[model samples]
Target: MSPLARKRLGRVALNAAGVAVFLFAVFPVYWMVATAFKPNDQIFTTSFIPFPDPPSMDHVSRVFTQGVAGNSIWRYLLNSTIVALSAVVIGAVFALLAATAVARFRFRFRTSFLILLLIVQMVPAEALLIPLFTMVKRLGLYDQLLGLIVINVGLTLPFSVWMLRTFVAAVPKELEEASWIDGAGRFTTFWRVLFPLVAPGLVATSIFSFITTWNEFVFALTLIGDQGKYTMPVALQFFVGQRSTDWGGIMAASTLMTIPVLIFFLLVQRRMVSGLVAGAVKG
Candidate 1:
């Protein structure tokens, strides 16, 4: 084969590999959605069907009507939303401030502080459950949504700070200097000049925090004592029983749980892409 032909063949192989990887990643999600709409009889049958022959809304309807664990399905969704949103908002603010400090200011123990943040991120959350639980209980935040929000913020904060510091540092110091020369106050410079550039990174971090908090299971399960206060992740467990699992209901609820994440990604995906690219170029 000529060199040009071999290069073309290699490109074709790469494209084929990319398509295969995409399909492998997407198949499970497609299956879940398909199964959610399948009738119980169809779902359990030996024959594999790519899509439901005649789709049914029975499972989805059951999830809404019958609810989960003595509370409406909406309640769990609301709890998850509240916790995720709260964590994202709180975590982002603190992360931004800390990032700003570390990125812009020189201080003693700065390296140590960054290292500590990394150490915290490296520590598995499961290992801290006992200490966190005791601390939450002592603070009288046990079994409350606030406790879960606080825990999520703490869990996500270190990574948020670490990720955001890079973005902050990537922002050209010349821009801030120019703003200062123009007599812009510190707050004005930050709000007007720095914020727009950092917004993408902030959005990316918020998405991460939101998704992490939304899908968080262990802390929600351990911290919350009230069944009614359970988030969607914990509530999904209601579909499982010792005798037989409600596969249909499980799939339906799982599908519902994924909608917010998809919506969030769609809303900010462009900014996220740009943010990542800009960070890479700047770094």
Candidate 2:
């Protein structure tokens, strides 16, 4: 083939690969939504049906009306939201402070502290489950939403601190110094100058913490004994039975569970880009 033809062929190949990857990632979500609307007959059918024949709202209606485990589905959703939001807010505050400290202040064993954060992130969460559970129990935080928030904060804090540290370090210290010379106090400089520069990283960290806590199941299940206190993930288990699984109900619930995440992402996603632009102009 001529050189131009070869280049065209490679471009086509790259486009094909991109499409394939997109399909791979999105197909399950599509299937789940489709299945949620499918009639029981279509769902049970062995044939591949990409779309629901007649999109039925039976499963969704049933979930709303019947609920799960004798508790309203809204309760589970509320619990999840509460835990996730609380963790995000608390974690973001501490992570930004810690990141700022690590980047700006030189303390004894500061390097060691950063390393320890990385080490904590490296260890699997399951490995720390037992110890965390014990500590939560001793502190009388177990079975409460506060405990879940604290656990999630601890689990996600290391990553946030470690990630935000880079953002903090990337910011020029001269800005703060200039503010200080201009009669700005330490808090003023931090809030007015430093915080804006670091906002993108903070938003990113908050998104991570929210998604991690929102989807967490093992800790939610093990820590909370009351069915009424179940988060969305734990509540999802109610759709499964000893001999059969409620595929439709599960899909509907899952679809419902996915919306808040989409909304949250949509809400912050613009902030992520805008903050970067603002920081660039400010710098």
RMSD of each: 3.0, 4.4
lDDT of 1 at 185: 100
lDDT of each: 0.90, 0.88
Q: lDDT for model 1, on a 0 to 1 scale?
A: 0.90
lDDT by residue (tens digit), candidate 2, 1-283: 9999999999999999999999999999999999899989889878899899889999888888888998878889989999999999999999999999999999999999978987888899998889999998999988899999989998889888876787899899999999999999999999999999999778876886798899998899899988889999999989999998999999999999998788877777764454334346557
RMSD of 1: 3.0
Worst 10 residues of 2 by lDDT: 270-279
Clashing pairs in 1: none
Provide the lDDT at 214 for model 1: 94
* Model 1's TM-score against the true structure: 0.88
TM-score of each: 0.88, 0.88
Query: In candidate 2, which residue pairs clash?
Result: none
Off by over 4 Å in 2: 1-7, 262-283
